[model samples]
Target chain A: MIASGYLISVIAAMGIVTFALRALPFVAARWLQRHALVQALGQFLPLAIMTLLLVHSATGAALAHAGWPWPELLAVALVVVLQWTRRNALLSIVLGTCLYVLMRNFLV
Target chain B: MNDSNDPAHGPQRLSVLSLSAPVAMGYVPLGIVFGFLFVQAGASWWLAVLASLLVYAGAAQYMMIPMLAAGLSVGTIALATLIVNSRHVFYGLSLLDALPRRRLLRWYIVFALTDETYSVLTTIAATTSDRQKLLVALLNHCWWVLGTLIGALIGAQAQVALAGLDFVLAALFAVLTVEQWRTKKSAAPLWFALGAYALAYGVAAKHALLLSIVLSLVAGMLWQAKSAASGEVQR
Candidate 1:
């Protein structure tokens, strides 16, 4: 088992970092609002960041299994399409995850 | 505040509950997965609960599990968390005026500004009361912690061998990505992200996410400059 002391320290550090990031804009709202670049990035970064996260996590999952990344690709595609058409977050996640688990368990 | 029977208060309370209900749906299951994986990876169940209660950022929490298991340094994990959650820095930009003005409520809202919370706060009517906004954040946090507690207990008891269960995180990211895409003003960021990831992966597979994030930041700056220059020309 991981040491509680070490784990607690890690948690504390992560919490501090996360809180700092989240509070940065609120603390610096005047400066952030004043800058055109900040506005541009505010428009630009969210989509980029979310897409990177999706790709990175999906890639990580694909690498965990051998051979083709077909399962990851298919499942992610289903999720994107389902979410796009239905606009239901829970449905898309549940169905996509269930399909991925099924393929990983039975097919390979 | 104590008047649940007051007709005016009832709908307002219901609206807050309705708003947070969807977030609960996502957070609970995702929190469960995080808890189960952390315990199954050898951390104590309560530590999983602690991480959920403390860290509260879903993606970073999920990413930390394998790193912690690998005995990576705390500094390394912190840097990775920063990269994974860098997007949050921008989340508050849009909510500067919308968030509560009081010290405690404001800070608590800031601390609880997960992707789901941010999206919900942004979509809710601007007339929403400060107390109601706090309720939404508080309720979402509670759902996440409750889910982690339940899952950690389950994980401590039995060892279920299941493959691809952790794919829930990726699925969650997919859902968030779709939502982001729907509200996108231009498609350039999407293309930029794809190219950046491909380039970063080719250069260093292990640091692809970090490198790609850096690349995208630089790209966003350059893209802004270009657009600004063209607007100057038009003017």
Candidate 2:
């Protein structure tokens, strides 16, 4: 039913993008594995990418705001402190999300 | 170094099978909801599978249903999907270090960049080899394909209720996070995430959250290297 030409086209575009990203290393790395430059870069790349992910998750995509999105910020802060103190990711996300809802409801 | 010869394949396959019980326990309801929502949005079962395969980003898939429900444009949908999944770009880069040196292992590593694979791979990294990494990637890929295809197929015809199962993914991530914290010492990644979130929010207005992820991952690596070097010197 949702078979419009545009929707199909969009899906194809997405497929191409996803394929390219996933396909690059699959094709390139097969031959280049032992290359020194490649090896040197490999060690720290994951940490870097992950850091960006955490920061984005923590701050939640709002650069240049006046007061900041207090609730989301608060939620991220709580998750970090709890995770740091207790090393608990589950509690961090659950409690953080709860805090997010509360902040959305009353904090702002 | 062929895929079939990967030593990591055993653990990777085991982990895939290992996670399945939980997913089967989890995906049916979630898949049904996705199915119902897709159907409600005028998409066929076939379309759901296409979306799942082409755009395997989970939350984006859920969000797409609503966007379609609202009759949004294809361009708008594409842009939204891109933004939502922008964080995923980092996953490949991370695999570069451990899996990059071996070209044979590298190709398979990139194909399996889903959240589940990341969790499983990160957990087994210290113990992993080229074969192991390939197995992990391939096995993880199988899990997503199975969960998604099964969900789409079953969800299309029936009204199975998986309301609270949304938390299953959170729960899975929680499991992985706890394991990581207990076994490893690099809490910086988490902190980096929080810090990045804060920074992106404070200055930039464009989905500070996404910016934080990219920035935090970049910065986190810098800090990790700095600390690793200092630690190496102290030793």
Candidate 3:
């Protein structure tokens, strides 16, 4: 375990970086608003970032174990199907999470 | 556009808390899981509360537990967090024109623009009063903080049978990705993400997420530039 002082500092550091990122465009509002590169990135980056996060979550178990994470894959598939058909975020997340918990404990 | 400001349709009639109530369904459970994991990783409840209060980025907070347990350096943790929450930069872009003019309120809106809040704000009509927008942002922020406090208190008091609960974070991300894909109906970003992840994983298994994010952003920009050039030639 790390020291308490270090942990607090780490948390503070994370907060500072996060707040800075959030404040970037607001701080540089004029330049960012006029910059074509920033605009193009602003449009495309959200989906790409979301997809990257999904991959991070999906591959966490598989990467850790050096094998395919069947349960996670299947649960994510279920989430996609549920969200697509039902069009409900809460339902899809809750049901998919429950399925993952059940599968990891028993099936996997 | 002007209906929201009419005396009959005043802010008092539309309680900001009600607008934020729907988010509780998502935030409460996830916050509890984060708190539970934080305590499970042998951290104090106060630390969990402080992190949630200050950082307030869900995925980064989740990643912090494992990183902390592994005794990583503070600088490394900070860098990892910056990468994980880098998406917020773009989110801030989308809200630039809509954010309030007052410096303090604008800064607060910037500080509280979480993924959920961004989605809500962007989907709402542009005519929404600045007051309503700020109210929604503040209310959602409170929900997350309150949920984290509750979870930390519970996790500190008793051990809960939450063996597989960490997967909630994964599920939440999966759902959000699906939602974004559905809205955009574009496969290019998804393909770029997969390609980046595969390549990064081959190079560095542990840091693949950070690497893949950087790779994907670069690849996305290149693709955008190429497409723009081609359009110029055609025109």
Candidate 4:
């Protein structure tokens, strides 16, 4: 195992880099705001990014095992349906997650 | 606006924090999961706290657990983090006009802008004061940091093997994506994203996320450009 001091330094490096990524745009806000491409990205990119994240998460789960990730797939479906019908994010996520945990423990 | 005379300093600051209550539902649980996972990866609770305080990006921090265990180089970790959180740059673009001109507050807001806060701020009425926006940002930041610290403490003590809890991250993203779909009323972005992901997965499952994100963005921009050109043609 790496030493604690080295680990702490790594975390600090991570923190610095993350802060830089976040702060760069605000520092150049004027140019970014006026850029047509950035404007278009601002409008449409969130949905795409969100969708990519969903797929990435699901695929990560699925690829970890040889068989299908039944619980994950089911939980995602349940979450989507719940959010669609109820229009409540917290309820859907919390419930879907609980269902996934239960399925992972018992159903599998 | 004037930095010294900020509205957040006004009497209504409490309400701004209250407005962020909805975010607690997601941040609290997710933070706990991250803390638990961090400890499970053999890191101390203090590391989890340090991460939450410093790297506060939820998904990126979650990804850090596996990367840390693998003993990857710092450069790899930093690059992966940049790719994952690069979406924040877009968030900054959307919030730029709404942000206060004061240097410190602006920097804080920019640093604090996560996916949930961005969603909340963007949907808030345009007339909402800068102080309220700052409050929302601050409250969410506090919720996440505190939640992580609490979770780390519990996790360090219990050492409970809570397998499958990591799925919370996936579930959170699923909910967010569904919410976006419902509001936007267009399936093109979703389709493009799915297509890119599938293709990238086929080509390289390990690097599929980064590849798919790049592919999806390219496809989205191309589609937008084509549609705009067609509109001009019709006009």
The candidate scoring highest on DockQ is: 1
Clashes found in each candidate (C-alpha, N, C closer than 3 A): 0, 42, 0, 0
TM-score of each model's chain B: 0.86, 0.55, 0.81, 0.77
Model 4, runs deviating above 4 Å: A1-21, A63-66, B1-13, B119-135, B183-185, B231-235
Tens-digit lDDT track of model 1 for A43-74: 78778988898899899888998889999999
Off by more than 4 A, model 3: A63-68, B1-13, B122-133, B160-162
Worst 10 residues of 3 chain B by lDDT: B10-19
lDDT of each: 0.88, 0.54, 0.79, 0.78
**Ranking of all predicted structures according to TM-score, beginning with the best and ending with the worst:** 1, 3, 4, 2
Error of 4 at B188 (Å): 2.2
Off by over 4 Å in 2: A19-108, B1-32, B100-105, B159-235
List, residue by residue over A1-108, the lDDT tens digit for candidate 3: 347898899999999999999999777877877766666665566677777877787787545443468888888899889988987777887898899888777765
**Backbone clash tally for model 3?**
0
Decreasing lDDT order of the candidates: 1, 3, 4, 2
Per-model DockQ:
0.69, 0.18, 0.62, 0.55
Listed in order, each prediction's TM-score against the native is: 0.90, 0.49, 0.85, 0.81
Residues B1-235 of candidate 4: C-alpha lDDT, one tens digit per residue: 6653777565455556666887897788788878877887788888888888878898788777767887878888887777667667766666767877888888888778788888888887778777787879888988898888888888788866655777777887888788768767577788888888889989998788779878867876776687668867999
Better-scoring candidate (DockQ), 1 or 3: 1
The model with the greater lDDT, 2 or 4, is 4
Native A-B contact fraction in model 1: 0.81
